[model samples]
Target chain A: MLRTVLTAAIALAPMAASAAEVVSAVLRIERERPAPISRLELPAGDEGFMGALLATRDNETTGGFLGHTYVLHKAAALPEDATAALDDLIEQGARFIVTLAEADDLLALADHAAGRDVLLLNVSAPDDRLRGVDCRANVLHATPSRRMLADGLAQYLLWKRWDRWALVHGSHPRDREKAEALRAAARRFGARIVSELAFEDTGGARRSDTGHVLVQRQIPGLMQGLREHDVVVVADESQVFGVHMPYRGWTARPVAGDAGLRATAWHPAHEGFGATQLQRRFEALAGRRMTDLDYEAWVALRAVSEAVTRTDTADLATVLAHLLSDDFELAAFKGMPLSFRPWSRQLRQAVILGDGFTVVSISPQEEFLHQRTRLDTLGVDEAESACPL
Target chain B: MRGFLAGAVALLALGPVAAWAQVVFVTNEKGNSVTRIDVATLEVIDTVPVGQRPRGITISNDGRQLFVAASDDDTVQVFDPETMRLIHTLPSGPDPEQFVLHPSGNPLFIANEDDNLVTVVDVVTRRALAEIPVGIEPEGMGISPDGRVLVNTSETTNMAHFIDTETFKIFHNTLVDSRPRVAEFTRDGSLLFVSAEIGGTVSVIDPASGEIVHTIRFAVPGVTPEALQPVGVRVTADGSRVFVALGPANRVAVVDGRTFEVKNYLLVGQRVWQLAFTPDERYLFTTNGNSNDVSVIDVAAERVIKSIPVGDQPWGVVVSPN
Candidate 1:
């Protein structure tokens, strides 16, 4: 259906000879790599890259009326060194670049484009260091940081009066960082971390003929002697063993964090506050449910489009200025006007807490209040941010 | 003094004869019932159980039938107003949230929140006439006084889809604030007001051009912006006053229709969802969802006169025309 509409729109495009200025956006995505676990299904298509394309279409829908047109340039399968890719897009008159890269690569790209007249939007990484000590003036983060996601889940857990948590983590660097975020959230929300355990990632095939029996016995034994806790929090972004801990725990407790009732930027089951429309549009365009990375990429591109349309300027400096100003706010169907925090340049948004099939709740719960904005209560606030910019 | 004495004597002579007995119907979403209130006596006369999750309620053009959108049941239950009994059920689309009747009294436009379609059903035939494809999660429905144009607000899309009544085609889509829940037109049909629940503002749109002319924002002294969610909108018959229900703030903001400035905020019950006016426009009723009651506001006095307890989660309200 979306293809038919686009084809019809293209067929009718030449009839309107209005001289509309064109706004160009470039998306740079990393090449697909094999997952650590063979059991995990790979996404059928590029997640964040497809989201940028759909957002460009959405931008054109409104931009067409404002004497503006949008053009998207896709740079897929880019190598680790994004310098050449950035230079190529910059040479092609692309002022806005949406980067779907890891934290280190994103920082490198940001530094490479620092003195240039371009803005880079980070849409994939959720590293706290990027929003804190290594924050960049030219780079804005659309995805929520690890701390924000942890705080969002912790707020709900506290609201449910589940103050004691049993922390479990995998043997990975990213998992350790995520566990640290959970620890910080526990301290911030007055929750007690009663027990901490680590599961070693033994090198083996994730699935075997008799793996379920081993997992059923091993998971229960791993959690047998834990102290009494209200909830079991797992930090396993590597998808190692968290999936086995949900129904296999010995105490029959609810799981949270990276598994079970998880907090994410977007969920496919979210239909409240008009999110159903977005889900329908995404499915129509991408032929699948939108993932969290897709939503972040859409938000990044939409932020650029919003600034351009509001200011009526394609000038990079002017658009960036408008985006960073206090007056700029983007309505991305999160039930509130989403804006960026000036201190860290992190977009403030509501996080969804879901139980795989349906959305259980949204963060920034009624009890967690902030002086300036309630959304700021979810992540590192301006007062605590280490970024000098 | 002589004029005052004459007015006092006239009031005594008129008595209850001048007061009209109005019936206000409030739909309780969670309780699946409708509470009928007698305006003159200020009492809940009867509570009729209808269907599962009744949200939107309205009266027919002739005032003979009352329509309530039973969202969960996927039907719009029709009731005889005089007898307060279910007469028939119209096949509404899935998850019908709100609906509006055409001024010509033939077709009803219903917003299906889950299906992303607007189901147009014939009132008398009780059959669907047309189902128009709209933006996602269509919730609010408004028809022009002349019935030439119909507007549906999609909550997630944040766009007010202006549908041509004659063609049943979307002529224009105007983007409003976040989570637009209600759309209302002025008496003259020149201006349209869309309340965005999460955007915290009411956008005054120019219906013809599909452009937002002005935005009305509410700011109470102690109320936070997150809690000041604008949901239901009601414009007076004369188009002089516009009332907006602030969802969690528990207040109704009265806006000067012509000047586009907020005049006053009348306190109501918790989590007000929808509003309706009496036939004479003398009083306005608000369904407070959290408090599970209906608040009666004397329009002339601009104050809440009474709070009558009703069913659980009172969502939508409509008064009889006669």
Candidate 2:
């Protein structure tokens, strides 16, 4: 079926926006991933692309009325072949690309697209540098920065008056960065890390059987004699041990960070702000629960949709300009309208703190005030932004 | 003889309840209770417990039955207004957020947020007459004054579905701003006003052609643009003034009915959301969620006359006619 469509497009040769065709793409670079602590956390094959697909349909609902149709090209590649895939999409005349990749590959692609009339949206990278010192004008990010997620969890913990933290981190680079973000949040929120430990990844089965007697016994012994803390904050971005530490804490305190109370962009069980229907619609299309990556990708594409719907044209430059402008605010089902920041080009949105089943709270926790919008309190504020653009 | 004369005088004091032109009922979402206030005295009459997470409260046109959407309970509980007792339950699909009654007073069209369908229930038979599939997260049900058309606005879908009353089928859909919370029609049913909560604008649509005639925007000096979310909308019976409850902005915008211009914004309690007017149209009561109170606005003067404290998280308010 895809071959037939491509051939038909080739036969038509000189495709133009005058045909009411709006073209975009999703370029995903698949890197080797460490498994999560449970089998239930396994990812579907089309995790992020499925979200873009749903968004194309939603865009068409409004775009069809305006005499425009949306088309999304999906491509996935391994780390080594990522740039080739990106080039393939660019050759197909896709100017707007939503990328699902880690920091290194994503930045490489952005650099490769330089001076090519291309704009890339990062939907999965949590590296602060991508939005901070390494920020680019042609790139916009919808994913929450590591500090934003850490601060969202930190605010909820502080609001509960749980000021003392038992900080535990895995011995990986990404995990260390997550740990650093957590430490930054603790200092920013007036909390103290009373105890700290680094758990070395000894290379065992990642999806460990919880009922195994030996693993159960080894877990509780780690935090046995720690100093008294109100909560156990774990930073295990490599999926080493955070999920396993939830119910096995020594002091019977609650766990947060990448475990029990993780901060995210969207949650499946989140029913607030008409999200129940959104959740249902995605389930109908994808036949699965909408993951955080799916939601970020969906938001990125919808930004283009909102721009196209408003401008009533399929012109990529016009739509891209509106997407990055102050006049553009899309109702993103986050209890508010969302827009990109002028300095860093990051999507400003609220973070959802959930426990996998239900939403615990949303952050920027009413008391934390900003002279601007309260959402600025979660991540890098404008005054503190390191981005030159 | 003195005892009998005093008892007769007590009957006169009770007679004021019947002579009252209207009374107020506020639904407290968190408190799970309904508060009734006397219009004559502007005092609390009684507070009665209802179903879980009670919202979208209203009285019948003839003022006999009061309907409340117990959203969490997934049912619409009908009650007797005078006695404050639950009469029966209508088979509301699921999570009935808001609903509108037909002018003939037989069927009520309800917006079921969870099911993505609108359940039409017969008030007299207490049965679901039809379930019409609509856009996702259906809310804001508004019927025409002549009872020919029913409009249901879905928040996530951002479309106003126009359903024919006779066929109980969706005939046309008109796209509006995001997160539309209320759909209101003018008394003559010529124009429809739909308020978008997150979009912070009201799209005035011509129901006949399903075309948007004007889009009204609101701004206050001290409030941020992002904070100005328009929720509940009410147009006066005379169609001269349109009042919109601005969610989180804590102000109600009074608009010119014909020009669709924002005339003024009257400050009220915190998170002022839903609104209801007295039968005489002299007073408008707004349910303030955060402040746990209701702000009574003098319609003619465009001023908040009083703030009466109610239960926790007051969500919806309605007044029974005389």
Candidate 3:
């Protein structure tokens, strides 16, 4: 009798349903990373999973009003144990999964989960190819691509009248990819790349007692013969020497890109646009600060929750359909109602530019405009679609 | 000479009432003080130190006392409106961010953002009467004009829990947009307005049916849709107009009460968070968080007459009743 009234009332509008139901999702994560050179940068053993934990509680808050309970499972696995983890979750009846894996692994998982009535929400992988040439229809991305971050930083630098850049990239593949993205950003934003140089990895003990002493001399030596530039943009995603280039620049120009005033999806120091309260809530829940990966994982589950709430159903197919529709918007406290780019399925958000402590700016800096959304000015636009899906 | 001296003394005695008819108080969440502004002069007259992180503020119907939610201190500090002296404090639950006074003016419902309950305190008894479980992160509190129903909006729950004033039990839950910051009812008790900050829309519900009657969306010419977040809401006594504070968009949307059509957008200070109106409804004051100032809107003309500088992080505002 109550079900009939609820159905009728739901048909009229989205009245709070009185029927008991459970909505479950899984965070399929690859939890292996290179050892951090600094203790300050070490993982807390609950990086992405903690975000899912907090977001599950948050989802449960809204779900409780309508007789819905949200449960999230964290399926963390190492690199070699990926397929087994994926199979385990599938056997456990996981239909909605927010995956935090590397690009190739993510693609493999997407291929594995395809046609199984399962959808993957990518939370951490920043590879543009995942959203570009290798784009999968079943996978949606919550994290911004590397191009988005580079473009976001470039816009802010140009807005600050620092249009001339001296680029320095590491020897690693990830660093090269980031440097290439920076090149794309420069071309798009009309910034001049005065000089481009690559620093060799020459792998050694990154955390020696003489680490800073060697870095202080080597960084200046690298910056010695650089052309006259307004800022030094470093692409060191591996975090080898990015931290050393800020104060050790040959000229006293400001450092940017992956170091100094860097662009990121989320930062612990951000307090604007009601983010302080959010940070406080996170701190209260996790007993630590939030990171970009945690925030992206949180966004993934939240994206799923938004669809579930709007559709008033936990059916994975309906939720995914609703999410892919134009009516979907995620209010993730970035002073915007973030939506997915139709061509790439990448979640559009403001890139926060900060110096590790203060949020200097959020970009697509007011000058660079897009036809649809200013957020589109940062990443891949629909007209340039390399993504066939 | 003796007649002139006597006449001067009599005029001076009536000076405050004749000139400064009303007092407007604003709570500063960062400055840990409340700034009092003389409504007639549109100037800050005094800043009285209060507890830490004061946010929600209200005044008594008779205009005798003022109440402020000292959120970080976990207490609601009450003060004499005229003297600016501490009257007493009612025990607020942990992290009381916002609260609403009962229309009959006894029980106060304080929404505890940390705890998932609405703490009800009786002003006369100065003790908590009941802790009503509503939803998670409850912040906005609204009571019907006829004093039969109370509405509390949970920020995370994304619903307005309607509770019976007599029994203090949640009778119905009306789903709204994300991060609903304020819930307000029309003076006639016919319509309810719940402002969602992140969703950027105001859902107007019918009190009797508990169904949304209208949804008001705001748009400014150059402003991005994302920046237009609705937080604080105020409806006129005659139910002719509605004023909504658009957070970060820094504008107040004026809507026609009858037609629910947006009439105009009045641009105010930066990051506008809350709103309050003078007793006569002639002037509306808004607390701008980023700018640390208050913008006074002349309601009849629908224009900002003055931007009065206040303390740091001004969050809530309330004007004297009389």
Which candidate has the highest TM-score of all?
A: 3
Residue pairs that clash (backbone atoms under 3 angstroms), model 1: A274-B156
* lDDT digits (tens) for residues A244-298 of candidate 3: 8888888899999888999999999997655766677788889999988778888
lDDT string for model 1 (A307-364, tens) is 7766666777888888888867777767667898989999999999998789999998
Give a tens-digit lDDT track for model 2, residues A1-389: 11221110111111122446778899999898866668788888788898899888776654543456788998999989988999999889887799999999999998888778778989999999999899987789989899899998999999999999999999999999999999999999999999999999998676545455666687789999779999999999898878888777666899999899999998999977667667878998999999988999899988887776666666767877888887787777787788887778888888999997889998878778777777888887788888877
* DockQ of candidate 3 against the true complex: 0.26
Error of 1 at B130 (Å): 8.3
CA lDDT, candidate 3, residue A374? 83
Report the lDDT of model 2 for residue A307: 76
The prediction achieving the highest DockQ against the true structure is: 3
lDDT of 2 by residue, B1-322 (tens): 2432443466577785544335799999999999987786677777789999998888898898999999989899999886677999988777888989898887898888866678888889777877776765788989999999999997766778888888776667787887788999999999999999988899999999888999999989867777799998999998999999997899999999999889999999999889999978999999999999999999999999999988999999999977
Per-prediction TM-score to the true structure, in the order listed: 0.83, 0.83, 0.92
All candidates: CA RMSD in angstroms? Answer: 7.1, 7.0, 5.5
Sort order, DockQ high to low: 3, 2, 1
The ten-residue window of minimal lDDT in model 1 chain A covers: A6-15
lDDT score for residue A330 of model 1:
75
* Candidate 1 lDDT tens digits, B36-153: 8877777887788899989999998667889999987888999987566789988887778899999988799999876667888888877777777776568999999999999999
Of the true interface contacts, each candidate retains a share of 0.10, 0.18, 0.24
